[model samples]
Target: MIELKDVYKTLDGRKILQGLNLHIREGETYVIIGRSGTGKSVTLKNIIGLMKPDSGEVNIMGQCINNMGKEESYALRQKMGVLFQSGALINWLNVEENVALPLVEHQRHLSKSEVQSIVQHKLELVELEHAGKRMPSELSGGMKKRAGLARAIVGNPKIILYDEPTSGLDPVMSNQINDLIISMQEKLGVTSICVTHDMSSAYRIANRIGMIYEGQIIEEGTADQIKNSQNPIVKQFISGSTVGPLTQ
Candidate 1:
Protein backbone atom coordinates (compact mmCIF):
# COMPACT_ATOMS: atom_id res chain seq x y z
CA MET A 1 0.00 0.00 0.00
CA ILE A 2 3.06 2.21 0.40
CA GLU A 3 6.12 2.32 -1.85
CA LEU A 4 9.24 4.41 -1.85
CA LYS A 5 11.18 4.11 -5.05
CA ASP A 6 14.78 5.20 -5.39
CA VAL A 7 14.09 7.99 -2.95
CA TYR A 8 16.77 10.54 -2.22
CA LYS A 9 16.55 13.21 0.45
CA THR A 10 19.11 15.66 1.81
CA LEU A 11 19.24 18.62 4.15
CA ASP A 12 21.88 21.34 4.14
CA GLY A 13 24.36 19.14 2.26
CA ARG A 14 23.74 16.16 4.58
CA LYS A 15 22.22 13.18 2.81
CA ILE A 16 19.62 11.51 5.01
CA LEU A 17 18.25 9.05 2.52
CA GLN A 18 20.19 7.83 -0.50
CA GLY A 19 18.36 5.98 -3.24
CA LEU A 20 16.22 4.20 -0.66
CA ASN A 21 13.56 1.79 -1.86
CA LEU A 22 11.03 0.08 0.39
CA HIS A 23 7.48 -1.22 0.28
CA ILE A 24 4.74 -2.16 2.76
CA ARG A 25 1.78 -4.09 1.47
CA GLU A 26 -1.79 -3.65 2.66
CA GLY A 27 -2.68 -5.22 6.01
CA GLU A 28 0.96 -5.90 6.74
CA THR A 29 2.93 -4.78 9.79
CA TYR A 30 6.35 -3.83 8.51
CA VAL A 31 9.03 -3.01 11.05
CA ILE A 32 12.15 -1.02 10.24
CA ILE A 33 15.12 -1.35 12.60
CA GLY A 34 18.21 0.75 12.18
CA ARG A 35 21.04 2.40 14.03
CA SER A 36 20.48 5.89 15.42
CA GLY A 37 20.85 8.66 12.80
CA THR A 38 20.67 6.17 9.96
CA GLY A 39 17.56 7.89 8.55
CA LYS A 40 14.87 5.49 9.69
CA SER A 41 12.86 8.40 11.04
CA VAL A 42 13.58 10.38 7.87
CA THR A 43 12.17 7.51 5.80
CA LEU A 44 8.96 7.61 7.85
CA LYS A 45 8.75 11.38 7.53
CA ASN A 46 9.04 11.09 3.76
CA ILE A 47 6.15 8.63 3.64
CA ILE A 48 3.97 10.93 5.74
CA GLY A 49 4.90 14.01 3.67
CA LEU A 50 6.39 15.67 6.75
CA MET A 51 9.62 15.61 4.74
CA LYS A 52 9.95 15.69 0.97
CA PRO A 53 12.37 13.67 -1.06
CA ASP A 54 14.82 15.56 -3.21
CA SER A 55 14.27 13.05 -6.01
CA GLY A 56 12.15 9.92 -6.43
CA GLU A 57 8.61 8.85 -5.68
CA VAL A 58 6.52 8.07 -2.61
CA ASN A 59 3.39 6.21 -3.56
CA ILE A 60 0.55 5.58 -1.15
CA MET A 61 -2.42 3.65 -2.42
CA GLY A 62 -1.00 4.32 -5.92
CA GLN A 63 -1.01 8.11 -5.53
CA CYS A 64 2.42 9.64 -5.89
CA ILE A 65 2.87 11.83 -2.82
CA ASN A 66 6.20 13.26 -3.92
CA ASN A 67 4.51 15.60 -6.37
CA MET A 68 1.08 16.10 -4.81
CA GLY A 69 -0.30 19.60 -4.54
CA LYS A 70 -1.02 21.11 -1.14
CA GLU A 71 -4.72 20.30 -1.22
CA GLU A 72 -4.08 16.83 -2.54
CA SER A 73 -1.47 16.17 0.09
CA TYR A 74 -3.76 17.25 2.90
CA ALA A 75 -6.50 14.98 1.60
CA LEU A 76 -4.09 12.08 1.35
CA ARG A 77 -2.81 12.75 4.86
CA GLN A 78 -6.30 12.26 6.28
CA LYS A 79 -6.00 8.56 5.51
CA MET A 80 -2.97 8.02 7.70
CA GLY A 81 -2.11 8.25 11.41
CA VAL A 82 1.18 8.74 13.23
CA LEU A 83 2.34 8.00 16.77
CA PHE A 84 5.49 9.96 17.42
CA GLN A 85 8.35 8.82 19.65
CA SER A 86 7.60 11.37 22.33
CA GLY A 87 3.82 10.78 22.30
CA ALA A 88 3.41 14.44 21.25
CA LEU A 89 0.22 14.80 23.22
CA ILE A 90 -1.27 18.15 24.00
CA ASN A 91 -0.12 18.66 27.55
CA TRP A 92 -3.00 20.99 28.24
CA LEU A 93 -5.78 18.84 26.84
CA ASN A 94 -7.41 15.92 28.53
CA VAL A 95 -7.02 12.51 26.95
CA GLU A 96 -10.52 12.56 25.52
CA GLU A 97 -10.02 15.91 23.87
CA ASN A 98 -6.63 14.88 22.53
CA VAL A 99 -8.07 11.72 21.04
CA ALA A 100 -11.01 13.63 19.61
CA LEU A 101 -8.92 16.39 18.08
CA PRO A 102 -8.31 14.57 14.81
CA LEU A 103 -11.98 13.80 14.33
CA VAL A 104 -12.87 17.40 15.08
CA GLU A 105 -10.34 18.67 12.55
CA HIS A 106 -11.01 16.17 9.79
CA GLN A 107 -14.62 15.13 10.10
CA ARG A 108 -16.73 18.25 10.07
CA HIS A 109 -19.84 16.31 9.17
CA LEU A 110 -19.79 14.42 12.45
CA SER A 111 -21.59 15.93 15.41
CA LYS A 112 -19.75 16.41 18.70
CA SER A 113 -21.64 13.50 20.22
CA GLU A 114 -20.62 11.26 17.34
CA VAL A 115 -17.03 12.37 17.63
CA GLN A 116 -17.07 11.71 21.36
CA SER A 117 -18.30 8.19 20.75
CA ILE A 118 -15.54 7.59 18.23
CA VAL A 119 -12.95 8.91 20.64
CA GLN A 120 -14.28 6.71 23.40
CA HIS A 121 -14.20 3.69 21.16
CA LYS A 122 -10.64 4.37 20.12
CA LEU A 123 -9.57 4.87 23.73
CA GLU A 124 -11.16 1.58 24.61
CA LEU A 125 -9.41 -0.08 21.73
CA VAL A 126 -6.11 0.94 23.23
CA GLU A 127 -7.20 -0.11 26.74
CA LEU A 128 -7.43 3.39 28.10
CA GLU A 129 -11.20 3.59 28.41
CA HIS A 130 -11.31 5.19 31.82
CA ALA A 131 -8.30 7.41 31.43
CA GLY A 132 -9.95 9.87 29.04
CA LYS A 133 -10.09 12.70 31.57
CA ARG A 134 -6.44 12.43 32.55
CA MET A 135 -3.83 14.88 31.38
CA PRO A 136 -0.45 13.94 29.93
CA SER A 137 1.35 14.83 33.14
CA GLU A 138 -0.93 12.52 35.05
CA LEU A 139 -0.07 9.53 32.91
CA SER A 140 2.79 7.08 33.14
CA GLY A 141 5.05 6.50 30.16
CA GLY A 142 3.07 3.50 28.94
CA MET A 143 -0.21 5.28 29.52
CA LYS A 144 0.95 8.19 27.46
CA LYS A 145 1.93 5.90 24.62
CA ARG A 146 -1.43 4.16 24.78
CA ALA A 147 -3.15 7.52 24.78
CA GLY A 148 -1.14 8.45 21.71
CA LEU A 149 -2.23 5.25 20.04
CA ALA A 150 -5.83 6.07 20.89
CA ARG A 151 -5.46 9.46 19.32
CA ALA A 152 -3.83 8.00 16.23
CA ILE A 153 -6.74 5.64 15.52
CA VAL A 154 -9.51 8.03 16.52
CA GLY A 155 -10.01 8.97 12.89
CA ASN A 156 -10.04 5.35 11.82
CA PRO A 157 -7.07 5.83 9.53
CA LYS A 158 -6.17 3.30 6.86
CA ILE A 159 -2.49 3.35 7.80
CA ILE A 160 -0.62 3.94 11.05
CA LEU A 161 3.04 4.88 11.39
CA TYR A 162 4.68 4.28 14.77
CA ASP A 163 8.04 5.85 15.56
CA GLU A 164 9.65 3.93 18.42
CA PRO A 165 6.51 2.71 20.13
CA THR A 166 8.57 0.78 22.63
CA SER A 167 10.98 3.52 23.61
CA GLY A 168 11.31 4.59 27.25
CA LEU A 169 9.02 1.90 28.56
CA ASP A 170 9.60 -1.05 30.86
CA PRO A 171 9.88 -4.53 29.36
CA VAL A 172 6.32 -5.53 30.28
CA MET A 173 4.96 -2.28 28.96
CA SER A 174 6.90 -2.67 25.77
CA ASN A 175 5.45 -6.13 25.26
CA GLN A 176 2.00 -4.79 25.99
CA ILE A 177 2.44 -2.13 23.34
CA ASN A 178 3.66 -4.75 20.91
CA ASP A 179 0.59 -6.88 21.56
CA LEU A 180 -1.64 -3.86 21.10
CA ILE A 181 0.01 -3.08 17.77
CA ILE A 182 -0.51 -6.65 16.61
CA SER A 183 -4.12 -6.60 17.77
CA MET A 184 -4.81 -3.37 15.98
CA GLN A 185 -3.57 -4.81 12.69
CA GLU A 186 -5.61 -7.98 13.15
CA LYS A 187 -8.75 -6.19 14.26
CA LEU A 188 -8.75 -3.13 12.03
CA GLY A 189 -6.73 -4.46 9.10
CA VAL A 190 -4.67 -1.28 8.99
CA THR A 191 -1.35 -1.17 7.20
CA SER A 192 1.37 -0.34 9.69
CA ILE A 193 4.99 0.81 9.47
CA CYS A 194 6.85 0.70 12.78
CA VAL A 195 10.29 2.32 13.10
CA THR A 196 12.05 1.00 16.15
CA HIS A 197 15.32 -0.19 17.68
CA ASP A 198 13.68 -2.78 19.92
CA MET A 199 14.45 -6.10 18.36
CA SER A 200 12.01 -8.05 20.52
CA SER A 201 9.19 -5.66 19.73
CA ALA A 202 9.99 -5.86 16.02
CA TYR A 203 9.96 -9.66 16.06
CA ARG A 204 6.68 -9.71 17.92
CA ILE A 205 4.75 -7.28 15.75
CA ALA A 206 6.30 -7.40 12.28
CA ASN A 207 5.02 -9.58 9.49
CA ARG A 208 8.05 -8.45 7.53
CA ILE A 209 11.18 -6.80 8.89
CA GLY A 210 13.68 -4.51 7.19
CA MET A 211 17.06 -3.39 8.40
CA ILE A 212 18.19 0.11 7.53
CA TYR A 213 21.81 1.13 7.76
CA GLU A 214 23.54 4.25 6.52
CA GLY A 215 20.28 5.61 5.08
CA GLN A 216 19.32 2.52 3.08
CA ILE A 217 17.44 -0.70 3.69
CA ILE A 218 20.12 -3.34 3.66
CA GLU A 219 17.96 -6.39 4.31
CA GLU A 220 14.25 -7.29 4.19
CA GLY A 221 12.74 -10.58 5.24
CA THR A 222 10.15 -12.34 7.34
CA ALA A 223 10.75 -12.32 11.08
CA ASP A 224 11.87 -15.94 11.20
CA GLN A 225 14.00 -15.49 8.13
CA ILE A 226 15.57 -12.46 9.71
CA LYS A 227 16.38 -14.44 12.83
CA ASN A 228 17.96 -17.29 10.91
CA SER A 229 19.69 -15.26 8.22
CA GLN A 230 23.47 -15.46 8.18
CA ASN A 231 24.06 -11.96 6.84
CA PRO A 232 26.60 -10.45 9.25
CA ILE A 233 24.91 -7.07 9.31
CA VAL A 234 21.51 -8.47 10.20
CA LYS A 235 22.95 -10.88 12.72
CA GLN A 236 24.99 -8.26 14.44
CA PHE A 237 22.09 -5.80 14.62
CA ILE A 238 19.50 -8.30 15.89
CA SER A 239 22.04 -9.68 18.33
CA GLY A 240 22.92 -6.22 19.66
CA SER A 241 26.56 -6.72 18.86
CA THR A 242 29.18 -3.95 18.96
CA VAL A 243 31.33 -5.57 16.27
CA GLY A 244 30.21 -5.90 12.64
CA PRO A 245 30.38 -4.29 9.24
CA LEU A 246 27.56 -2.09 10.57
CA THR A 247 30.05 -0.42 12.93
CA GLN A 248 32.37 0.61 10.13
Candidate 2:
Protein backbone atom coordinates (compact mmCIF):
# COMPACT_ATOMS: atom_id res chain seq x y z
CA MET A 1 0.00 0.00 0.00
CA ILE A 2 3.03 2.23 0.37
CA GLU A 3 6.22 2.44 -1.69
CA LEU A 4 9.33 4.57 -1.71
CA LYS A 5 11.58 4.47 -4.72
CA ASP A 6 15.06 5.98 -5.02
CA VAL A 7 14.15 8.42 -2.29
CA TYR A 8 16.79 10.92 -1.17
CA LYS A 9 16.31 13.55 1.51
CA THR A 10 18.70 16.03 3.07
CA LEU A 11 18.10 18.49 5.87
CA ASP A 12 20.30 21.58 6.23
CA GLY A 13 22.85 20.01 3.87
CA ARG A 14 23.07 16.83 5.95
CA LYS A 15 21.73 13.73 4.25
CA ILE A 16 19.01 11.89 6.12
CA LEU A 17 17.72 9.48 3.51
CA GLN A 18 19.93 8.26 0.65
CA GLY A 19 18.31 6.31 -2.11
CA LEU A 20 15.99 4.75 0.44
CA ASN A 21 13.55 2.23 -0.98
CA LEU A 22 10.83 0.39 0.87
CA HIS A 23 7.50 -1.29 0.10
CA ILE A 24 4.71 -2.03 2.55
CA ARG A 25 1.87 -4.35 1.72
CA GLU A 26 -1.76 -4.01 2.81
CA GLY A 27 -3.07 -5.39 6.11
CA GLU A 28 0.39 -6.17 7.50
CA THR A 29 2.63 -4.65 10.11
CA TYR A 30 5.98 -3.46 8.75
CA VAL A 31 8.58 -2.22 11.19
CA ILE A 32 11.61 -0.08 10.38
CA ILE A 33 14.45 -0.45 12.87
CA GLY A 34 17.55 1.67 12.91
CA ARG A 35 19.98 3.54 15.10
CA SER A 36 19.18 7.11 16.05
CA GLY A 37 19.56 9.68 13.23
CA THR A 38 19.26 6.94 10.63
CA GLY A 39 16.11 8.37 9.01
CA LYS A 40 13.40 6.07 10.40
CA SER A 41 11.08 8.96 11.29
CA VAL A 42 12.18 10.88 8.21
CA THR A 43 10.90 7.99 6.12
CA LEU A 44 7.49 8.31 7.75
CA LYS A 45 7.37 12.05 7.13
CA ASN A 46 8.12 11.43 3.48
CA ILE A 47 5.32 8.89 3.30
CA ILE A 48 2.79 11.27 4.87
CA GLY A 49 4.00 14.28 2.88
CA LEU A 50 5.14 16.12 5.97
CA MET A 51 8.59 16.23 4.31
CA LYS A 52 9.28 15.94 0.64
CA PRO A 53 12.35 14.06 -0.57
CA ASP A 54 15.04 16.00 -2.38
CA SER A 55 14.76 13.38 -5.08
CA GLY A 56 12.77 10.23 -5.92
CA GLU A 57 9.13 9.32 -5.37
CA VAL A 58 6.95 8.43 -2.42
CA ASN A 59 3.69 6.74 -3.32
CA ILE A 60 0.75 5.89 -1.08
CA MET A 61 -1.84 3.70 -2.72
CA GLY A 62 -0.30 4.60 -6.08
CA GLN A 63 -0.58 8.40 -5.55
CA CYS A 64 2.72 10.26 -5.71
CA ILE A 65 2.86 12.37 -2.55
CA ASN A 66 5.50 14.77 -3.88
CA ASN A 67 3.30 15.76 -6.81
CA MET A 68 -0.03 16.13 -4.99
CA GLY A 69 -2.00 19.36 -4.90
CA LYS A 70 -3.40 20.69 -1.64
CA GLU A 71 -6.74 18.98 -2.13
CA GLU A 72 -5.10 15.79 -3.30
CA SER A 73 -2.72 15.78 -0.34
CA TYR A 74 -5.57 16.38 2.05
CA ALA A 75 -7.53 13.52 0.55
CA LEU A 76 -4.51 11.25 0.73
CA ARG A 77 -3.79 12.16 4.33
CA GLN A 78 -7.42 11.47 5.25
CA LYS A 79 -6.73 7.81 4.54
CA MET A 80 -3.83 7.66 7.03
CA GLY A 81 -3.32 8.08 10.77
CA VAL A 82 -0.15 8.81 12.76
CA LEU A 83 0.65 8.14 16.40
CA PHE A 84 3.54 10.41 17.20
CA GLN A 85 6.55 9.46 19.33
CA SER A 86 5.58 11.58 22.30
CA GLY A 87 1.85 10.89 21.97
CA ALA A 88 1.64 14.52 20.74
CA LEU A 89 -1.46 15.00 22.82
CA ILE A 90 -2.77 18.45 23.49
CA ASN A 91 -2.06 18.76 27.20
CA TRP A 92 -4.95 21.16 27.74
CA LEU A 93 -7.48 18.94 25.99
CA ASN A 94 -9.05 15.99 27.75
CA VAL A 95 -8.71 12.55 26.24
CA GLU A 96 -12.08 12.53 24.54
CA GLU A 97 -11.56 15.99 23.11
CA ASN A 98 -8.13 15.05 21.91
CA VAL A 99 -9.47 12.00 20.17
CA ALA A 100 -12.25 14.06 18.63
CA LEU A 101 -9.92 16.76 17.31
CA PRO A 102 -9.40 15.05 13.97
CA LEU A 103 -13.11 14.83 13.36
CA VAL A 104 -13.57 18.37 14.55
CA GLU A 105 -10.88 19.69 12.21
CA HIS A 106 -11.27 17.54 9.10
CA GLN A 107 -14.85 16.36 9.35
CA ARG A 108 -16.62 19.51 10.39
CA HIS A 109 -19.90 18.41 8.87
CA LEU A 110 -20.44 15.80 11.59
CA SER A 111 -22.61 16.79 14.51
CA LYS A 112 -21.11 17.02 17.98
CA SER A 113 -22.93 13.89 19.00
CA GLU A 114 -21.55 11.97 16.05
CA VAL A 115 -18.03 13.07 16.86
CA GLN A 116 -18.46 12.09 20.50
CA SER A 117 -19.78 8.71 19.46
CA ILE A 118 -16.77 8.08 17.26
CA VAL A 119 -14.34 9.21 19.94
CA GLN A 120 -15.99 7.06 22.58
CA HIS A 121 -15.90 4.05 20.29
CA LYS A 122 -12.19 4.52 19.69
CA LEU A 123 -11.56 5.01 23.41
CA GLU A 124 -13.40 1.78 24.06
CA LEU A 125 -11.34 0.03 21.42
CA VAL A 126 -8.20 1.12 23.25
CA GLU A 127 -9.72 0.03 26.58
CA LEU A 128 -9.78 3.59 27.84
CA GLU A 129 -13.50 4.26 27.72
CA HIS A 130 -13.62 5.43 31.32
CA ALA A 131 -10.58 7.66 30.93
CA GLY A 132 -12.15 9.86 28.27
CA LYS A 133 -12.63 12.68 30.71
CA ARG A 134 -9.01 12.55 31.90
CA MET A 135 -6.36 14.93 30.63
CA PRO A 136 -3.06 13.83 29.08
CA SER A 137 -1.12 14.88 32.15
CA GLU A 138 -3.39 12.79 34.35
CA LEU A 139 -2.76 9.59 32.41
CA SER A 140 0.20 7.25 32.68
CA GLY A 141 2.64 6.98 29.80
CA GLY A 142 0.88 3.89 28.50
CA MET A 143 -2.50 5.54 28.87
CA LYS A 144 -1.30 8.59 26.97
CA LYS A 145 -0.04 6.39 24.17
CA ARG A 146 -3.35 4.57 24.08
CA ALA A 147 -5.15 7.88 23.94
CA GLY A 148 -2.92 8.92 21.06
CA LEU A 149 -3.76 5.66 19.34
CA ALA A 150 -7.46 6.31 19.90
CA ARG A 151 -7.13 9.68 18.25
CA ALA A 152 -5.27 8.15 15.34
CA ILE A 153 -7.95 5.56 14.60
CA VAL A 154 -10.91 7.81 15.37
CA GLY A 155 -10.80 8.92 11.75
CA ASN A 156 -11.20 5.30 10.61
CA PRO A 157 -8.02 5.51 8.60
CA LYS A 158 -6.85 2.77 6.25
CA ILE A 159 -3.17 3.13 7.21
CA ILE A 160 -1.58 3.72 10.63
CA LEU A 161 1.95 4.99 11.13
CA TYR A 162 3.32 4.39 14.63
CA ASP A 163 6.47 6.27 15.67
CA GLU A 164 8.24 4.44 18.50
CA PRO A 165 5.00 2.97 19.81
CA THR A 166 6.63 1.31 22.81
CA SER A 167 9.31 3.85 23.55
CA GLY A 168 9.04 4.86 27.20
CA LEU A 169 6.96 2.26 28.99
CA ASP A 170 8.03 -0.61 31.24
CA PRO A 171 8.28 -4.11 29.84
CA VAL A 172 4.75 -5.04 30.89
CA MET A 173 3.27 -1.86 29.53
CA SER A 174 5.32 -2.20 26.40
CA ASN A 175 3.94 -5.69 25.90
CA GLN A 176 0.42 -4.38 26.43
CA ILE A 177 0.96 -1.69 23.81
CA ASN A 178 2.37 -4.24 21.43
CA ASP A 179 -0.69 -6.44 21.98
CA LEU A 180 -2.92 -3.47 21.34
CA ILE A 181 -1.10 -2.74 18.08
CA ILE A 182 -1.51 -6.35 16.97
CA SER A 183 -5.17 -6.43 17.97
CA MET A 184 -5.84 -3.15 16.25
CA GLN A 185 -4.33 -4.43 13.02
CA GLU A 186 -6.28 -7.69 13.21
CA LYS A 187 -9.53 -6.02 14.17
CA LEU A 188 -9.32 -3.00 11.90
CA GLY A 189 -7.32 -4.56 9.02
CA VAL A 190 -5.30 -1.37 8.68
CA THR A 191 -1.87 -1.41 7.14
CA SER A 192 0.71 -0.47 9.78
CA ILE A 193 4.23 0.97 9.56
CA CYS A 194 6.17 1.32 12.78
CA VAL A 195 9.59 2.90 13.43
CA THR A 196 11.33 1.80 16.59
CA HIS A 197 14.71 0.95 18.12
CA ASP A 198 13.32 -1.78 20.37
CA MET A 199 14.13 -5.09 18.81
CA SER A 200 11.81 -7.05 21.06
CA SER A 201 8.88 -4.81 20.22
CA ALA A 202 9.80 -4.94 16.56
CA TYR A 203 9.95 -8.74 16.62
CA ARG A 204 6.64 -9.02 18.40
CA ILE A 205 4.68 -6.59 16.25
CA ALA A 206 6.21 -6.77 12.78
CA ASN A 207 5.19 -9.20 10.06
CA ARG A 208 8.24 -7.93 8.22
CA ILE A 209 11.22 -5.97 9.46
CA GLY A 210 13.54 -3.60 7.60
CA MET A 211 16.82 -2.35 8.95
CA ILE A 212 17.97 1.10 7.92
CA TYR A 213 21.66 1.93 7.95
CA GLU A 214 23.44 4.94 6.45
CA GLY A 215 20.14 6.27 5.08
CA GLN A 216 19.35 3.17 3.04
CA ILE A 217 17.37 0.00 3.69
CA ILE A 218 20.06 -2.62 3.97
CA GLU A 219 18.07 -5.60 5.11
CA GLU A 220 14.38 -6.55 5.03
CA GLY A 221 12.37 -9.71 5.50
CA THR A 222 10.12 -11.61 7.89
CA ALA A 223 11.06 -11.44 11.56
CA ASP A 224 12.84 -14.80 11.37
CA GLN A 225 14.64 -13.88 8.22
CA ILE A 226 15.87 -10.67 9.75
CA LYS A 227 16.99 -12.51 12.86
CA ASN A 228 19.02 -14.95 10.76
CA SER A 229 20.44 -12.31 8.47
CA GLN A 230 24.17 -12.65 7.86
CA ASN A 231 24.73 -8.96 7.13
CA PRO A 232 27.13 -7.54 9.72
CA ILE A 233 25.16 -4.35 10.18
CA VAL A 234 21.85 -6.13 10.62
CA LYS A 235 23.43 -8.62 13.01
CA GLN A 236 25.05 -5.87 15.05
CA PHE A 237 21.77 -3.98 15.30
CA ILE A 238 19.46 -6.87 16.24
CA SER A 239 22.04 -8.35 18.61
CA GLY A 240 22.62 -5.03 20.34
CA SER A 241 26.34 -5.34 19.97
CA THR A 242 28.32 -2.16 20.47
CA VAL A 243 31.58 -3.59 19.15
CA GLY A 244 30.56 -3.16 15.53
CA PRO A 245 30.20 -0.64 12.74
CA LEU A 246 27.57 1.43 14.60
CA THR A 247 29.14 3.85 17.08
CA GLN A 248 27.96 6.04 19.88
What TM-score fits each model? 0.97, 0.98
Model 2: lDDT to the true structure: 0.94
Relative to the unseen true structure, what is the C-alpha lDDT of residue 103 in candidate 2, on a scale of 0 to 100? 95
lDDT of 1 by residue, 1-248 (tens): 99999999887889889989998999999999988888998998999999889998999999999878999999989999999898899999999999999888878899989998998899889999999999999999999999999988887789999999999999999999999999999999999999999999999999999998767898999999999989898899899888988777
Off by over 4 Å in 1: none
In model 2, the Cα lDDT at residue 209 comes to 97
Q: In candidate 1, which residue pairs clash?
A: none
- The weakest ten consecutive residues by lDDT in model 2 span 239-248
Candidate 2 local lDDT, 87-144, one digit each (tens): 9999999999999999999999999999999999999999999999998989999999
RMSD of each: 1.0, 1.0
